[model samples]
Target chain A: MITVTGTFTVKKNKIEEFQTGTLELQNASLNTDKGCIEYKFHQQQDAPENFFVYEIWDEMASLELHGASQHFNKFSKLLEGNLDKELDIRIYNTI
Target chain B: MITVTGTFTVKKNKIEEFQTGTLELQNASLNTDKGCIEYKFHQQQDAPENFFVYEIWDEMASLELHGASQHFNKFSKLLEGNLDKELDIRIYNTI
Candidate 1:
């Protein structure tokens, strides 16, 4: 399995907007992607603007497909200027 | 629930040792702690020396208690000098 973890920092006061868009993308990924095993989003408790996304895919190919999906494309467009920094992503494999 | 994400970098040539110790601690935490909801460990694919730990507890107090548990203390001692860097932890709440 391929696990992807993304740490994101949202623009000030934009958490609600960011979360809504993320939920839309997350739902689409879960429903439309055959290999998406898990998709979960989390918000930092101390710093509300920080977000984390944890995902599990069957393989690298499935993750690539998810990146190219329409919902993801839309989300990328929506998040263009709403982020505090570039996404910090780390890909992992179960040990 | 309280969610904690910790990023770790392990010393070279010590992943096997680290993983074994970690698995022991993880199992102990899961089986012995009533508040531990989930405990998962992941190894970075590109950087095999790096690790990520995802944990969920019933509340802040449970997390505190877990930290004080014997298994955790033993694991901490085992991890001393075995890690390339201090654990970078972030606390989050599901949104």
Candidate 2:
């Protein structure tokens, strides 16, 4: 299995707006992808403006496919002007 | 299943040290807990200093148990002066 994690910084007070768009993108991605094991979004209680996206896929290929899918492209583009800072993304494997 | 996501902000340049401690704590937690399905940490490519911790447990109770465990407490304390900001923790359910 492969896991992809993204830590996003929404503009100081723009969390709600960002989440509205993010949820739509996440739901669409999860619903359409067979390789997705889990896709979840979280916000820290203490730092509400910071967000995290956690995803698990069946394999590296599945993850690559996810990156290449239309839904992700849409999501990526959606971040263009909405982010307070650049998105942080990382991939990992079971240790 | 219950998913716990934590967005942590390590001191601007303390990511490596934070991760070393985090990995040890995560390994200990996973090895000792039967309910832990997965525990993974990720750093974004665009923002390398940003980190996310994703965890899946069998249920909310299990997740609660994890939070009360020694490993977690140890990890929490370890973050005391090492963080640049407060930790972000959130819980989510599969929808």
lDDT of each: 0.89, 0.75
Give the poorly placed runs of model 1, Cα more than 4 Å off: none
TM-score per candidate, in order? 0.95, 0.60
lDDT against true structure, model 2 = 0.75
lDDT of 2 by residue, A2-64 (tens): 778777777776777767767876887789887898787767546667777778888878878
Docking class of 2: incorrect
Where is model 2 more than 4 Å wrong at Cα?
Answer: A1-53, A56-95
Local accuracy of candidate 2 as per-residue lDDT tens digits, B3-27:
7877666786787787787788779
Worst 10 residues of 1 chain A by lDDT: A13-22
Model 1 residue A64 distance off true place after TM-score fit, in angstroms: 1.1
Best by DockQ: 1
Residues A41-62, model 1: lDDT tens digits: 8999988899899999999999
